[model samples]
Target: MSRSLVIAPQWIGDAVMTQPLLRRLHARGERLTVGAVPWVAPVYRAMPQVEQVLEFPFQHGGLQWGARRRLGRELHGRFDTAYVLPNSLKSALLPFLASIPRRVGYLGEARVGLLTHRLKNPQDKPPMVAFYSALSGEREGLEQDRPVLRLDAREIDAALAAQGLRRGGYLVFAPGAEYGSSKRWPVEHYAALAASLQQPVLLLGSGKDTPVCEAIAAAAPNCRNLAGHTSLAQAFALIAAARAVVSNDSGLMHVAAAFGVPQVALFGSSSPLHTPPLNDAARVVWLKDDPGYQPPLDCAPCFARECPLGHHRCLRDVRPERVAGLVQGAVSSA
Candidate 1:
């Protein structure tokens, strides 16, 4: 039996995108284990392809060399090969210290010496699912293999009860993008969209989004702000049962895609070419450059958290009415 370990991505969206790689490995009859942070571990744990999930408690960008070394020691000789998913130098440290014979990953962060099977990242910058599955040497049929999450039905039902929510007939709005404000559509726009629709709205986001969600909920009486209150697992269950999702490019957007929920995704400060949703059910609305506009949209998708130029025309210009039209259509069709 082929035994392998994968060092998962730090971001929840990226973690969900890694499922295609897991499925490929599983198809080859490999026994896979995942190493991930607490925030992302549940994603992998829900995948049947993963044999085990190891929690890595280190904070982002913090070296925590000692912790990595200790964990590496504990993991020594347990796997024959390791797949380093993150490009950061630190992402490869554990496998290096663990003495895994075969380490595979893109040659990034100038950490050349750490990996034995160093692969070059393609210059084309394919969608995230394709980018991740490239390491598995199976590029064909990847686009068709959408990310899948298997959550306990009982847990999902319990979470809905706790949130005073029910399955089906409700619309979900994810207005926060952890990437930065640049990626987020204006909260006022979300509020306007909420007001336009008659269906109940569940506004979702992390603690960072509570204020924005509150503003949206306040503006639209039909919207309920659940940002910062629900755990990631609960959020998954909620998205799984949503009638349709309207969101910025974020983790939950990917989650909705995984569950085959029809979604209207807004892209700003990021390129859909880089992280487009794998599910065909999603409709991407990318309006980075609108010709003849007052502010030249030529410099959009700066990929910055905050708009460097102090104007987020990339998102701000894509008015609420446009998005509301799409949502109305989705709801009506559903």
Candidate 2:
């Protein structure tokens, strides 16, 4: 079998969306190894198609040309092909440095010369699963590909045990959006929904999410704020075992989708059309489609970090009762 090196995307959601692409490559008789940063390494670990994951030490920005060169030297001639998932110029640099015979990626950031095979970025923002699957050189049926992920039962059990919980016994609420407040459903709304849920609500996120999760937990007695308290592996394990999940269009939302957990994904400044959770059990809530809503959102999908109009009505207008109904209905049916 030919060896293929997959350069993973930095964001957790994007990493999960790449699973379909990985599946395509794996189905074609390629032994896949993913190169990822520590933050998203566990995501690839959950993908059964990935043979191994090599954690890169590179930080967020700047080329770090010296570091890429050294790693490239170490990896020279070890792979038959390379798949660069991110469009950034830096993302494709390492493969070029390694002299990987075949590098596949999109035409991005003037990286025309870095890749041996390249696809044009779609004129329209397509579903993320389809966007990544194009890297496999298949253009048809892109929308039908759904990402799937698996976690060890023991790990899920361990994560629940540590939290004094059990599989399917609690709901996971991811209330923070790394992108900014624009995508987040209001904390007050989250608290109201958590209070109404029959099962315990476990709030999960990074350190940056601590404040919002804390406020939600404080407002609802059944909610436990675990933000910043659990490792990413622990977070994934918890989400995998959750009875259901309620989150913004963030990484954990995609995690739940990949695990096939029933989830309600709320979108505000973002559009679900582009990155909707690729799971049959997932329900997306974006007011952009609601025609009856007064003072309709014309600025929706602004894709801005902060709401340009200073009123996140796109999200805030979505009442807690609406989401509570979705969760309760799914939970009871489950």
Candidate 1 lDDT by residue in tens digits, 1-334:
9899999999999999999899999999889999999999989977889999998978888789999999999999999999999999999999999999999999998889999998888777678888888889775886666788888899789888987778886889999888888888998899988888778999988899999999999999999999989888888888888889999999988888888788899998898878877666777787754555664667866788899989787888877788878766665664
Candidate lDDT scores, in order, read: 0.87, 0.92
Task: Provide TM-scores for the models.
Answer: 0.94, 0.98
Enumerate clash totals for all models, in the order shown: 0, 0
lDDT of 2 by residue, 1-334 (tens): 9999999999999999999999999999999999999999999999999999999989999899999999999999999999999999999999999999999999999999999999888888888899999899887788899889898999988998998898888899999999999999998999989877756989999999999999998999999999999999999999999999999999999999888898999999988889898777887788999888887788988999999999889999999999988876766665
Question: What C-alpha lDDT, on a 0 to 100 scale, does residue 84 get in candidate 2?
Answer: 99
The regions of model 2 sitting more than 4 angstroms off are none
At residue 193, what lDDT does model 1 achieve? Answer: 87
Stretches of candidate 1 exceeding 4 Å from the true structure: 289-296, 332-334
